[model samples]
Target: MDNRSYFLEEQRCVKKNGSQEISAHCDEELHFDIPPTAAWGTTEVQLREDLTEERQETLEDTANAFQGRGRVVRNNTHFCALTSCPRILQNKKKGKMGVTFRNSASEGSIFIGKRTVKDGECCGVWDVAGKYSIIMGPQRKWMMFSRFIFMDRLIADSHQYLEVRYRNGKKENKRGPLSMFEDPIVHESIAVMNAVTVDAFEVIVVYSEDEHGNVKRNVVHGPTVFIPDVNQWLHVFRWHGSRGKDLHEKVPGALVFTKLRTIPDQFYYNAEGVRTADDTSLTVKVMVFFQLTNLEVMLNSTHDPIGDFINALLADLMNFGCSYSYEQFVQNAQQLSELDTFPVMCGRASAIGFTIGKVVYRGYAASTQLQNLCESAIKTRTELKLKAEEQEQRERMRDYEVRGAHGRGDAERAEELAKQEHQLAMRAAQHQESLKQAEDAHSKALRQKEQMAQVELAAKVAEEQAHLAYLQGLKDMGVDLTQYLVSKSEKQPDKVLKVVTAPSHFSALPINSVSHIGGLNIHTNV
Candidate 1:
């Protein structure tokens, strides 16, 4: 609390002490040796004493103004002591030069510099030093970048390939399972295209440039790979829909046909309100089958083969149907399924490189009234035929019965005739036996009569011989033969006979001398 003022010179002090003496207060300087690693290195610093009174007063007044504030104020205007510090010295360290780029083996980018590099090659410090750029050339110009393109399995199996077209019109083909970047020519390629795959049953027509650069058409068969050149392309085929009175809408489309095998197709047609010869209206439905024979001829002859078939078939059906009445057509409807019914269609098909296989008249449709009438007529005709057949069967049965009765009667009459002939033959045999026995009895009686006559003649001859001998002996004894004859005549008087008609002169002679009396001469022993 003592308020007083005092003054002190340099290097001296005034104190409360009784005697005056020399003061130790003086301006001192301090030196600090900072190392190179610190912010400031190898520098000197000085500490100054409070020597000015005015500066002290000014500080005292500032302190009095902020006496009750609880915070201290600092002056940082001269916090740094160095006058010119070199800009914060940075450490000098070496680093890598080039930017890193990463990519897969299947993918790649073009880098242009002194030389081109691709196919997933790495770029290092040496590349950057050589001024190489990715997908860029000198002056940062854009360049071509390509990645690996894989062919599909189906295409590869079919022997298909890819064609690379160059900017100079040079063409080259590459097979599948390859990368574009692997080949150096890819850098100069303008485009790459896949080749067309041909199957076993297919064919293709193409327009291509020949060796002389002239465009010409050529046909390529199946089972091969068709790689077109830079100036080659496939031929486009357009198909038109069928057009006819029976068709309501035209069908339009594009298709490629198979030329190596047989192709089958069918179509239906209807003829409405068609009149027959008997003025009967009918709706006829027709179906047809066709096959392609020659493809070149078909292309040249017609634009729509199916349309031609329908038209031709319709014409033939109309001609045939109109020629017959309703009844006649019904009887001959079977002819419709035959090939002869569609002569016009067949001829047209052959001309247009096609063959018609079969034609079927699906049948006809008529009004209800006409159908009912036809059914009635058929029923009546069938009934009449059945009745006639039954009558004929009855007549045949009656004729067979009559023939059987006549055969039985003829058999009985033959048996009766045989019995009568047998009886007549037995009677004739009995009569012949009786005649033979009677003739044998008459012959035996005649033989016995002949034997008896021969015995009697022999006895008479013996007696006459004996009598002559007796007469001869008597004559020799002088006996007379006349007496002996008389004696024998007397013994058999009945057998003796006399002659009455003698001469008159013989009667006069004696009876004893009759032998001489007839002549008038007797010699009797008189």
Candidate 2:
């Protein structure tokens, strides 16, 4: 447009219900670099290509590995295309914000912090505004694209035009620089454009960086919002970046961005059908990041960066009458917030004075509550485990006492048994002594009795001699001689002795009867 030329490539048709739709689009192909960090093996974007035979082959070579031009891909083949823009500074304080370089050092410990810049700030390498590009699929309707800058600057000077190019796979003129400044000056507030919606956007990425500088990526289907509305908020604003450990660490590299919502309102094509603005102060501080690396972006819903330009063309803005309102927050939000989020905005547009739907607000509230519950549950579990350990320690002390008592009882029983065993041994010795004394006494008594019996027997022998003399005298006298002689025969009528006796009667007396008849004999046995 520097040469005063005009051609419309993309336009917005405002739906009867106030939502905008892509009604008419020119058949076009524009190439933007596959950010070196491209998520889908798309290393560079082909925003605009020169239709040169040599360049075509190169394009094919670069895009050969890309699946459906990175709309989606298999496995980890998707990588976010990354481009390092030279630094530019706009800060009135500290220093300016401009492109800077870093040696891709493998060593850790090298971390860069945020560089702050203030208003009226401008710093691009002279005659070398850092070049940026994009590669995309061939589509008739223009969707939206996203960009991240290290810093921000408001466009105070007249304007700067965006150069664009496109190409088809046709080897013969298959690709070439499609157009430069396809639309007029975009994003910045030009006299002809509406305020771009550069505020309150979301960047969802589930991604991580590798030691070898590889990035794994996936695309997040973000909340749907009017693309132009997204662009207006993207206008030049301050950004802050920080590095820290996350899911992947030991050492981790991360850049989180915080942006100032600059676009301000719903984007529309302006009175000249070229620029846009709004009545609502649709702006807030929100940070955006592509948590997903290679979207395998089967469906990417990136917000428009040219919101103001698109809004200018919408008939509703003119009918609604541009009224402005700004709602400022008392505190800054560093993490993702639910207030005035995209989903909320979808159901209800919360201008400084707009009303919101109840269901949408409730959903956001529930989401926050769920996150809190998870955190609380984790904390509670940790506390309970700590308490359990304390109880276990107490139990150990109690068990120690019980074991000590059991050991003492065993020792006491052993001592008592030893005393009883000693008493039994003494009793046994006494019994043996008593038994020996009784045996000695019995032997003495037996000897005495034997001597006495012998003495008595001697006396009896003398008496028997005397009796024999008397018997002889009687025989000589011939008085009853026959009676005396018969006595001899009667002396021994055989007496039977009893040999068997009961054990209890072993020492009982035995008796023999004498026969007093003609030839009987009598004797007593003890």
Candidate 3:
């Protein structure tokens, strides 16, 4: 048997010549044969059959890959088409002005210096000739063509607001992102203005559209979100106007430029009223502090909210004043500031989106008649106090006098007691001395009696000794002693004589009988 082989292939390519494109085919195949020597032989062949649609699609994909093209549709007719050369805008100096415009007249139609337009071109040079309109397109886009314009001294300080006003009446009020440009947009329809800054210490009632298409109202402190379109209207209500200027004299219009900071409004009123109870008249000075709370409500409720608030405040003050007498009003004047009487007033203002911060009673002056009565009352109180003090002083003096008299009496009594005790002591000492002297005299008398007794005893003893000596001398001269004794007895006849006989043995008794015999009678004491 002989070996056989067959192969089929296809290829496609895209060819280009300058700007022309052409599609062509490149396909080849080969057949192999064995000769008698068993060597290999080859034959080239070209296929001429039509390809299937699927195969043709594959061939087209291969052709596209070769051409280096992706599957995206693009139109080059209107892509950056310009009729003439684009002029590069010159950079403006820091203090110069320019004009800008946008052509929204037609599609592929732009105006440049009144020249005729060509086909498939959309841009042209714009200068200070016509009105600038933001071209609205099918893509809902706006286009502006302009050069930069600058200002010499368009500064917005921290206390100033830079306001931008467009020709369509939209406004932007801000404080920061500072620039030295009056009108930053190089367009004839726009202008740069000034406004008082809404500082952080103040609030502004702004009317704006919300996401739900409702006209929303709220307070804004300082700069709000920025918007550059000229489709919205704006107005600012401030407590005060620009510095060094009055509110009425502040330039009006949406584009007027006056940089300032927001401050709270303070209203001072000097009013007169008659008290209800006493018919007394009073002049009062009061201060009112207030701020705007909502722009839409404020504008809707009244044409002039500030003036309305002041009038309402005065009415409320007078109403409150009528409730009390002159004295009561003077004493309770602070009640004017109380919110009790302000509810009705506050309600009227709050309907217009205005709030009262505070109300201060500055001062009040009464009539001359009331002043005289007050002075008299004060004088009376002073006199009463002085009288009470005088009475207290008199009582204190009387108490002092009583205490001094009691002290003097006590001193005198003490002195008298001391003197009496001293006298008693002296008398006792004298009595003791007298007793001592009497005892001494009694002792001396006893000694003298003893001496006298001793002398009498000595005299008796001497008399007895002399009598014995005389008797002894009589006994020694014994010549007639018996006779002498008898003679002496005779001479003293009254003297009794006694005779004594010696004791004999026969007669031991009867001595009296014997003495008689001896011729002498002797009376004897034996």
- Cα-based RMSD of the predictions, in order? 35.0, 32.6, 31.6
**TM-score for each model:** 0.36, 0.16, 0.32
Model 2 lDDT-worst window of ten: 103-112
Better of 2 and 3 by lDDT: 3
Give a tens-digit lDDT track for model 2, residues 84-120. 2112112212232223321111011101111122232
lDDT of 1 by residue, 1-526 (tens): 1222122223432222235322223221101112222232222211123333222222222223332313322231111123222221112112221222222222322222122223334221113234433331112222322222211111232244555555566777666644343233333442344566777656677788878989887777787767766567886554434455544233554233433334566666566666778888887877778887887787679877766776777787678778999888777778988998888889999998999888777888888999888778878887887788788778877877787778777777777777777777777777777776777777777777777777777767777777777788889889988987897665332222234555897776543322333334433321
The superposed Cα distance between candidate 2 and the true structure at residue 341, in angstroms, equals 47
Best candidate per TM-score, number?
1
Where does model 3 exceed 4 Å of error? 1-197, 200-229, 238-268, 274-276, 287-299, 302-309, 331-334, 353-360, 367-526
What's the TM for model 1?
Answer: 0.36
Question: Of 1 and 3, which scores higher on TM-score?
Answer: 1
lDDT (Cα, 0-100) at 317 in candidate 1: 68
User: What's the ranking of the predictions by lDDT, best on top?
Assistant: 1, 3, 2
The lDDT of each candidate is 0.53, 0.32, 0.49
Model 2 TM-score is 0.16
- Write the residue-wise lDDT of candidate 3 on 119-183 in tens digits: 22223222345443322111222222221111223446454555655556565665644643333
